[model samples]
Target: MAQMRFITALLWLLAAAPLAAQEDARPDLSIREPERGARARTYVLASLIYKDAEDGIDRFPLAVPELIQYVEDNTELDVRLRGEDRTLRQLDGITLLYMSGNNAQLRIGAEDRRRLGRFLQDGGLLYAEDVRPRGLGRFRFGDAGRSGTPFDRQFKELVKDPDILGAGGSRWRKVPRDHALYSSFFALPDGPPPGAHQPGTITDLEMLEYRGRVAVLFSDLNLTYFWGDPQAHSRAPSLRFGVNLLVFAIARQQAGPALR
Candidate 1:
């Protein structure tokens, strides 16, 4: 009765959410940096473990090192990649958690999920992605389709489940052209802004606000891949887009009670 279990879990989440909401209700303010270690300019938590589907192509790509360098090079912030020893419970000092898609899955169990879910509900942002998947119109997962293409099944589960992060609303829209990602700080003069998203090209990417504090950002396109390529350094438009996202997440995370 997997279906029954799923339904039961959903109901339990719905029933328990309001009480958790009230108990953790603090005015959306800056979370104090934890005292244990030297403070990073910006603490970024990345899920490094990845499980590729049987498919040949990757559904998600883990690009932690690439992303870390981008943040250091492009912004004033010093970002630290969280190790596995720590749990979400140790997130107090961190400003943002970057979920590297490369087939990454949340390691939390059934009970701990409620806490992580509540963390996002209580205003903690999680930036995640679903990298390119395999098994499409033509290409199979592998030799004679023996190995299937990479597909991030868990990622799909999290995004579609409203009880997990409350981003299932249709209002969770893609970042439009007007978003600061296309603004001057990143792109040089005369360069065109990132092109209009190709029709139906914006698959699975989303942005949504919760509890007036946390903002969840997801994209299928790999910013780390774009940032990691040495050739892309001269690609101002793409670089700008990458930098914009990094800054936007930081600024959005730090904004006070009014931000959504």
Candidate 2:
């Protein structure tokens, strides 16, 4: 009887171990409310679940808070940072969805893809960034190559989905240096900042335009890391770039039928 009880206890602990690990993997999904009567723009960071891999979301936990502080301090925009780390199912009223990860074959179900499609059609903007650190080397643009980073391959898969940005003949293309987004708030005369990765070549912001509105923007330079440690790295320019993106997203939403 004593031996049987000991074996049962051991089995129970083994069963609970995976559950504890899963709980630890999921970050807090709490939403921070804005000040009373403040017309705040909320940015939601998407926490994705990759198949057979540890959670790759929330790579730079400090990125969002730093961005919120920059926009509020430098601009008149009422920026509000909220959401602990949310999943796609919790993204109903979110205006801007920010996603970062490094899973090569990251997969989103068909239903989630449809939901994301509707979000863009309703004037929401999706911004995705490759969070892989520098010195990792470049991702192969075309064809399958082992040299490419996981994020590079995942980003390609994300924008190529027919139900997502690829619908209605939409596709990702480089944002022009003279585009209004470059000058939306702060003038990015030189365009995106040079990071450890993709140094000196970060000229244009990649965009996916649908019905004349930029529905999605992708960056491979790891801008989030710049925001992660602004003071330590003197990342004011990268913060400015983030501000421009938020301002541009709001403007597009206000443009309404003009965007069509």
Candidate 3:
């Protein structure tokens, strides 16, 4: 029965994906200043929720679910979905931050994922969203422009905060082509398969190596297109790249030092 349900879902998605999605469908995010009130919290429990929502509504919400369904059908893992939001930074002994997800292995600790972006326009750095906002491989799927996205402003604001950056310097650099991530599950000789992947026009995935481990991974393209694209299940590079990324997360965790 489970197998049948899974297969049915896949067929439904593939049949429903509109060709318009193939266009530049990634929404341009209108990330405003973090509102003055107590604030609404958004945390992704991995497969359940991939995009972050400030007003409780993500621009393109189909990517994560489509991606999750794609993973289950193609891979052996059966994911348990859970997506929610919670308070942040309130701590007893100097606040502690952690991220949680079912599909993606937990990084800092357990249970807490804000939107794909914590950085917002005119707000404190890294402190805006999830815990330990260090650099990482990141992307703003909403807008493709190199600059002027809400995430760009928010991230820049976070970078300025000394408390946020902590002692470790920004080891920000392009993920080396030979890094294990490229070939974690499937081999991509070039690099991250772009969402709006166009010939001669692409961006490298970036990462923040804090201490001896990779703290963050970022992408600028809306690789989400692959999630719902009709060619997803086939041999789409974006989908394959997404799979490679999730697989690499486990590999990265295994290599990181013991968690506190």
Candidate 4:
């Protein structure tokens, strides 16, 4: 275990260094388009299933694939979900980690937290959601049930360690109605369209920012459920919002940032 401890210590040192010089330590989590006149690109999106997560981790089974199909249908990008979504114990090769669940007691062990830290330092986006069961929006189970709400202290603890996630001391805020996320791809003129939950439960999306980019975005909208259920209300807008979110997360890398 001597080598392992040495490597871990090295990673901590790298985290304190410049983002540019972190190439060797950081995981490669970039999604960019091919060069002009070159072949188009393909992306594989997946959800994170952390350890000790028995329930809610895979709730709304059809959510991810449905969202992927929606993105491909509406945008120029070719996106597909890994088979049944990635059953990952590690974050290697993941540019965006879609972590959605409503279980307030979600528990991630120490090792996975370190993996997340390295992933964020590598410039990955963690898009979390509270996927309320169909027609069960009110089952919020009080504050803890919501994945990313400012009041969900349990979820906050998951990422509170700056030494672990490089985002210590951060807090969620109401994403302003004028935030570009509303119009990244589709035009959300009035801000995020209403979520699946009851009206006004959330006036806007909440985000945790880091390194000048959105490190985590939490929503109580039950968006994935809406996308999966074909008969659900506001299904179209939900899919549209999904596309906008995916585009915004990777747009910076698509611009050919020199970090990689």
Residue 103 Cα positional deviation in candidate 1, in Å, after optimal superposition: 5.8
Candidate order by lDDT, highest to lowest?
4, 2, 1, 3
* Ranked candidates (TM-score, high to low): 4, 2, 1, 3
lDDT of 2 by residue, 1-260 (tens): 42233233333322222222245564554434334445545645443433533332325666777787776676655445453555666666564677776554567788777777677766677787766532323642221112246776666676667776675433668877877667666678777766434334444557876655667787776777677665546588788888777666554543332122
On residues 28-123, what C-alpha lDDT tens digit does candidate 1 reach at each position?
Answer: 445453343344454454442333332212322333445555556655433343323135555454445655434433445555556557656655
Model 3 lDDT per residue over 212-245, tens place = 3455555545455445445444436766776656
How close is every model to the real structure, measured as TM-score?
Answer: 0.54, 0.68, 0.50, 0.72
In candidate 1, position 137 carries an lDDT of: 52
Q: Which portions of model 4 show Cα errors greater than 4 Å?
A: 1-38, 52-58, 76-84, 135-151, 166-169, 255-260
Off by over 4 Å in 3: 1-59, 77-148, 167-169, 197-202, 228-235, 255-260
lDDT to native, each model: 0.44, 0.59, 0.40, 0.59
What are the runs in model 2 whose C-alpha is more than 4 Å off? Answer: 1-58, 78-84, 134-148, 167-170, 198-202, 257-260
Say which prediction, candidate 2 or candidate 3, comes out ahead on TM-score.
Answer: 2
Q: Which candidate is the best by TM-score?
A: 4
Model 4's C-alpha root-mean-square deviation from the true structure amounts to 10.5
TM-score (C-alpha, index-matched) for candidate 2: 0.68
**Using alpha carbons, what is the TM-score of model 1?**
0.54
